[model samples]
Target: MKRIFFTLIVSVSLLFLTSSAESIDNLYLIGVVKKISHNKVTVNVKSNVCRGKKDFNISPHIKIKLEEGDFIRFQINSSTCKEKNLKILKIMKIHKPRMEK
Candidate 1:
């Protein structure tokens, strides 16, 4: 009986750990660029959990040029929501389809 209880506890703990890791990997957002500076960009976030204009720090290694009013999708670290450290892990611009007359 003791052995069975120990096994169950271990299984539950492993499950929690995996789920938390998956949640962190899924932290990303889609937004529109409001402004761009040397090491940061202001984005008008469109996600359900994070909506509004917020500034996100860009890594110095990422050299992508972005313009104002451009739509973008970016992945962020888990600390983004918690401590407001809004660092970008990956970033890409999204093009909108042109409307036909």
Candidate 2:
């Protein structure tokens, strides 16, 4: 039936759209909490290339309490090379305690 064929086509199209999205990950050396607005954030992130695709929202895996100096690894799902297109999936902060040499 035509109805059955149409339903199959719609399902296949949805699957392809979801699977084609890109993925990316990057390390962010956290600085001051610049601001928090909506689902977005602005922080001074330090990395080899200071500017890259990054997500503003902190991931759920990140502990509720964090400090300014913590270094965090951020994972995002997005289209490559677009700033606003990235979505954060996971966040792991690095704890570095100074060692006396």
Candidate 3:
């Protein structure tokens, strides 16, 4: 009985550790706004791992005006290493630094 209980506990602990390791991490991407509609925005993502156009649903609570061809940085809730299954959590516009004469 003692051996059986110990084995069960060890198995459960290993299972928990593996699941946590498999969990996704938040992803940050820099992109150019391609289009903005009612509740979704399309962006041309420029990144080493994930590139090309991707559409993300906008959070209803977030109210920010975006235009086509605007450079922006956005955060996704979580993504796979390949950046699949993306959901936008935050968005910010990237402004170029003014050149000093």
Candidate 4:
């Protein structure tokens, strides 16, 4: 009886863990450079973050280089928020790198 119960618990736990892991899929977003002032910025992303809202303050080290009216495609690999503010874990600069002679 003990062996059977232990096996059942383990199996159930495994199932839950697998299901949760599967649900945690990576999310992506494409943003347009709305404005860049000082070291801070705001972007307009479609299909991501706050119902595709405009003028969302970006977190630091997001690897974005964009000018006003320039579009930038980016994504947040992982994030954590405090008081509804997001902190980017992994980011990439979608713009092409400048050539060096």
Candidate 5:
């Protein structure tokens, strides 16, 4: 029947739209390093949507050595990155801007 065919087409379109939307947004977080251990690092979140301190797992391949006072920003859910809530995409030390004359 034409009604059954039309319903099938609409369902398929909705499925495709939902999947595409989910893949478009990637999550990221920026925070200040509060503590650093051998296998994990704790960060005080500085984003508008998220707050408080969270601990993230340290990946073996991560090149940056974190100190307690370092401020950092990193991305999550990357292909090569693992861990549930902690993946370091990029990191750097906190800096103060100097005045230019």
Candidate 6:
């Protein structure tokens, strides 16, 4: 009886762990540039944070060249307020490097 109970407990724990891991979204996220303003930004992402509202604010710590259609890499802080959204860590612009003559 003890052996069976131990097995059942381990199985339940493993199931819990797997479900939690699967539901967790990545901390690092990518989004498309939607709008930009001095010290303010908005991006469109597919994260659950969207919850049907895709636009989110980029934190003041965000470092990126403000431009429409650029992709941004950022991290989300669970403890941060909703108005600030997340921090943009990098920018990926779909452009060729300027030619140097």
Worst 10 residues of 5 by lDDT: 75-84
lDDT per residue, candidate 1, 1-101, as tens digits?
99999999999999999998777453689998888988889989898777888888987777777788878898887634555767887886566535579
How displaced is residue 7 in candidate 1, in Å? Answer: 15
Better model by lDDT, 1 or 2?
Answer: 1
lDDT of 6 by residue, 1-101 (tens): 99999999999999999998777343555566677776556666645654222444455664545677665555654423254445444344333234569
Candidate 2 per-residue lDDT, tens place, 4-95, comes to: 99999999998888776543354334333445555665655555444532446766564445444444555555433245644455665555
Better of 1 and 6 by lDDT: 1
lDDT scores for all predictions? 0.80, 0.53, 0.78, 0.55, 0.67, 0.57
For candidate 4, report its TM-score. Answer: 0.45
TM-score on alpha carbons, each prediction: 0.65, 0.41, 0.64, 0.45, 0.55, 0.43
Query: Candidate 3 — worst ten consecutive residues by lDDT sum?
Result: 78-87
Q: Give the alpha carbon lDDT tens digit for every residue of 1-101 in model 4.
A: 99999999999999999998877333456665666776555666654343344444456655555576554555443432112444333445455435579
User: Candidate 1 vs candidate 3: which has greater TM-score?
Assistant: 1
Regions of model 5 farther than 4 Å from truth: 1-24, 78-85, 92-101
Q: Name the runs in model 1 displaced over 4 angstroms.
A: 1-26, 79-82, 96-101
- Compared with the true structure, model 2 gives a TM-score of 0.41
Better of 2 and 6 by TM-score: 6
- Candidate number with the higher TM-score (1 or 4): 1
What residue pairs are clashing in model 6?
A: none
Q: After aligning candidate 1 to the native by TM-score, how far in Å is the CA of 61 from where it should be?
A: 2.1
Query: How far out, in Å, is residue 93 in model 1?
Result: 4.1
Which lDDT value does model 3 have at 41?
84
lDDT string, candidate 5, 1-101, tens digits: 99999999999999999998777344467778888878788888786655677777766777876777566776644432233665554554453334579
Rank all candidate structures by their TM-score, best first, as comma-separated numbers: 1, 3, 5, 4, 6, 2
Residue pairs in collision within model 3: none
